[model samples]
Target: MKLIRIFFLCLLTTNALIAQTISGFIEDASSGERLIGAAIKFNNQGVISNRYGYFSIKVNVEPVRLMVSYLGFETKEIEYTITKDTSVLIKLHPVQNNLNEVVITSSPKQELSSIDHYTIPLELVKKAPAFLGESDLFKTIQYLPGVQAGNEGTAGINVRGGTPDQNLILLDGVPVYNINHMFGFFSVINPDAVSHVDFMKGSFPAKYGGRLSSIMDIAMKEGNLQSWHGTLSLNPIATRLMVEGPLKKDVSSILVSGRSTWINGLIGLGTLISNSENSTNYGFYDLNVKLNYKLSPKDQLYGSFYTGHDGFRNQFKFDNSVYRFGLSWGNATAALRWNRVWHKHLFSNTTAYYTQYNYNLSQELTSEKRYNATTNSSIKDKGVKIDFDQILSNQNTLKYGAGLVHHTFAPENKSYQNSRMDSTAMNTPVESLEWSTYLEDEYSITNKLKLVAGVHYMGQHVQKSYFHSFQPRISLHANLTSRSKAQFSYNRTAQFLHLLTNSSLGLPTDLWVPAIPNVGPEKAEQWALGYAFQLNDSYSLTSEVYYKNMEGVVEYTDLSAFLSATNIPWYDRVTVGKSRSKGLEVYLNKSRGKTKGWISYTLSKTDRKFASLNEGNWFPFKYDRRNNLAMVITHDFSSSKTLSFNFVYNTGVALTLPTSFYEGALPSNYVHDLNNPLLINYKFYQSLGDMSQRNNFRAPAYHRMDVSYKLTKLKVNGTRSWIFNVYNLYNRQNPYFIYYDQQKLKQFSLLPILPSVTYQREF
Candidate 1:
């Protein structure tokens, strides 16, 4: 029996020796740099290298052709014969003056339309390193051209010469007002719950209604079809927990995610234990939930809901006693959606949603004298839309949709100066109901020529204000060749609401006001032309120029009227104006295996002509910056690890600052009497220390760098992984806001450099 066992062991050992693997390393021929994570494919099998640029794989064939590819490097295929299972080395040469890769996502069988230029995938979102492991839909799109990030911590995206508000943000076909949590440092969408994001910068599709400048569509995850999956994350400021699973075999699924800051609570406890007065406290929390079910093979149902809140507190210590003050805000949203495929060529989707936002402030001085005010707002949008998509052929397609929306806008219930002021003193709620119908056609005239055209007719009725308007859009694409294309687009749009703010800082005082009878709907006309090219399979480049003309824009005569007055409509406190913007955008992208990154630069100018100010001459817009540049790169050391770096440099944003100090606008005794009812009017005479232009002065140059590293797929048993990330690695101070205090006669900026870390686990 012992002899038989020994013979079996010897046979097993011989077989193992015969199955020895072939391994090798890849490096850049020019720079001689080790190409970590380079893809090596042979015999229908592929494997990525480790950080040491080493790879090993077993194969039956002794001789095979190995295909090696990496971004910015020429793809090479080498044939080598293996003798006695020996390791081999390969080198790849970098392509000189290679064109960047034109990475786009679109469904198969759909005609490629110029209007639908690019589609970003959700997997890329999850893979990309983000702030605190939090994936932001808007921030991810900034990597593309025609999109710019205005400030740190702010999801402000300037696209095609338009402001952030101009971009229509939609979640499952429902509009969302504020997409920020914790003021603006993070986005509201939890990466674990998102399924896809589709953004269009230039051309507007007929299937989409509302918003003029751009469209951002987000689709939430439809739960899991398999068993169950969950993740838990921890950071210095917050902790997050999420879970997803199938309710039934393959019919139903659900996902839930929640995050909350423990810093404030933990710090508060520490202060209490030490018997010390609390000077500052900040806290934020958010929740997200999604569910999906398959009613039939052709029908599906989904529901999504989100809520978040932010608060800050401070206490002033005096010799006699302590004074406490606090400021807080909150937002909530919920949506339900239904999608049904009528046939192989027709598709439809329907949605309903609701959203709310509120702010509160409270202050106490020795208890006897206290001030408290709470302002709450809610915009309930109940709507239903039916979208029909037909594929006439491989070359012709049509997408059409119609929707009806009922808006109930509730302005804040204001209470001021302690209990002396009542909440009912504010204006009554305003309700606007609107309905729109639109249709678009995408035609491929030839293999090299494509066109997209659509129009929308909108009707709004509310409080004696009736508006009927038509928005038209058209885009053309001419492929110069397989590697190049030329495109042009023209669009017209109208807006029925406006945001009135005193400063560019976007303070709480900034009010979102609806259009009234006196204030006509804002109208705009925009045109753009562009060229795109692809070199090899790893590089893509694009250049575009755009122009926009707007009229009937509203500006305030006195910033205080937007806050002090009640019962009066927004038109009574604002003045109509005109504005224009023109810009050029250039972008390049390269992504393959180990190294992936892009460079984006924008040269633009925005100007406003306020007939009521600056003698009607055009001046730069408050948020405009003449030039902006950004670069980002990511390197994969292995299949489970990566490092990301980002750098941004831009010209200063337009600002308004006093040229010199002065006592007051009025110096003569009769000047005050002459304008008794008007306070101190400076319209008739030149100001003493005026800056000449409201946005003439430029702020300091803006620049910053950030780096992060991700570690994933740590295995113990089953399907489990881990991720670690750090934001603002070098701690570069990216100024968010700069304001001049009248009392101190000095400028103050908010938020210095900040560092954050997060740990995550997935199953």
Candidate 2:
């Protein structure tokens, strides 16, 4: 018995002596900003850095070669032998003299391994040609295949025939209810404050839910841990600034960025130009703040907050009477998170978040104060979620999470000063609870093939109504060769809330409705197959074909009913339908060399059918186009000078125009205007007539070219740059909308040839 005990003890001691735990953070050497999704490998085994730039791996204590690689950065190699557990920070430098260069390798955990995900590097966002002299992440994403932009200069996104609201956008693990500012011309997010962006259109993992078409996960910079840095940028209409520094050296950090317009005192440029007190001012401002503190070697705490406001105020004074109209919309979000490293292979993150979006419109009369009124719409969300990542081995990794969200919605509320009509509210204040849980596993069946499978269970509760769904997702990747690959994926997604718009304009007042007994949730299933190949070491080509089917999509049955005098229940004016979308996309990108660019083309078809609309026949979706093509190029002239060019061509959107008009009765609530007693609210206030079908006509094709030149120079304390941008360089008058006038069909364009310049300084 003594001899057996001695043998077991010796075996245990030997195992402990051989195993070693190595952990550290990966960061940029110059900026001291931690890098995410970096790959670290040794002895044919590897691990990826987490979202917070932490990594841990267990390995033998013998001498071995360690390699670290990150896109757009120089890879490093080291040889080391550790006696016990070791912790070290890995710093990487950006490639010298060239910022547009990008390279992808067939690493085991590269972005493409997920089979349809895209990891857009931050450098690309900074180098792309800006719209109106401002860099926009959503605009850059719209140039990708399978994604469509709404109107000229609009930041609205429609992916794979899905509406803008259908995309689940996240910021630091918290949802953003609204991403629009300046009436959809600018997104709420400040590009300089973001660290990384991940976009997925298909084959979504179980960790994501509540969206049908796409997911955009954005990570904010965690502040510099070594030193302090700040940047200030200016444009013709807006200015922005960013600051990041360490609160406690190597222990805590903070980052703050703010953007506000200051053109003649915040959009009073119009008043300045006209020199009148009866002018209008419209502008927006955004603020972002984040703080991080290390509680221990294995635990960290984070807090982030963001708020943005857009307001339009107009006042007109005529003699002794005054008329004022104001419109405002804003969004606020906050998140508190805790990150813990339980073991070398186990990591967890717990987060509590709150988000709110609100819209307000008011009109007042000085002479008739009793007629003053206000309209408001709002939505709020508070939720807590926890996630765990368990790296079992090199062949398998398990991910699981659960969340619970309490939602409050006030669709639309109208208040009047007169006591005769008290107040009116549509889809009045309602409360709901959303609960979800997910589990997934990534298994490497072989060195050439990988399989990822997951399941998500989500449900909603509202006033004795319960809606639930079990969504399954799967993806398969096969490496055909060292430089070529093939992949296939299938995904099922569901949404418990719906955004209801009265018209195709997609105004800020669009109502948000939860899943009730009268209306069910929206669900979608998608299948995609793709192939990718690398040519030489500078270029890559990827092609994919996909099909999607969606059910429980809600649409307005009668717009006339909405304009009636009496209020109508939302469910009574809407009906459910189904939609089908299929598409083929081809993309070719250049990664290295003096000139970098990409060319993408897409062919797609989307149709919808309703039992009570369009005579129960199929019709094209309003935003559906048959063909879209885009090209982006950036040329490095020298170390301090660069040029960028962007071009896009899209087959026109589908629309319906009334061939003729017929006289119709006005709404009962419409009151005559004393200023123009004979004139109506609109010239064509009569009913729409001679309309053959919905989405039966195609608008004219849209094509535009933009160019920008950037010159960087050394400033007093930092670096400064001037960006000269010319929108519509060739002066293409693209169609923004079509209208009928004097029995003639006319096309209306929104923008003209415009040129703008921006100056940026970094210190």
Candidate 2 weakest lDDT stretch, 10 residues:
102-111
Compared with the true structure, all predictions reach lDDT values of 0.67, 0.83
- Summed backbone clashes in each candidate are 5, 0
Residue pairs with colliding backbones in model 2 are none
In the range 387-469, model 1's lDDT, one tens digit per residue, is 77664544466778787887777655565565354344566878888888888887778777888889988888878789877
lDDT of 2 at 606: 92
- TM-score for all predictions? 0.79, 0.93
User: Stretches of candidate 2 above 4 Å error?
Assistant: 1-21, 58-61, 83-87, 102-112, 263-277, 317-320, 368-370, 418-422, 426-428, 503-506, 560-566, 659-688
Q: Give the Cα error of residue 515 in candidate 1, in Å.
A: 1.6
Clashing pairs in 1: 99-539, 100-539, 100-540, 101-539, 101-540
The model with the greatest TM-score is 2
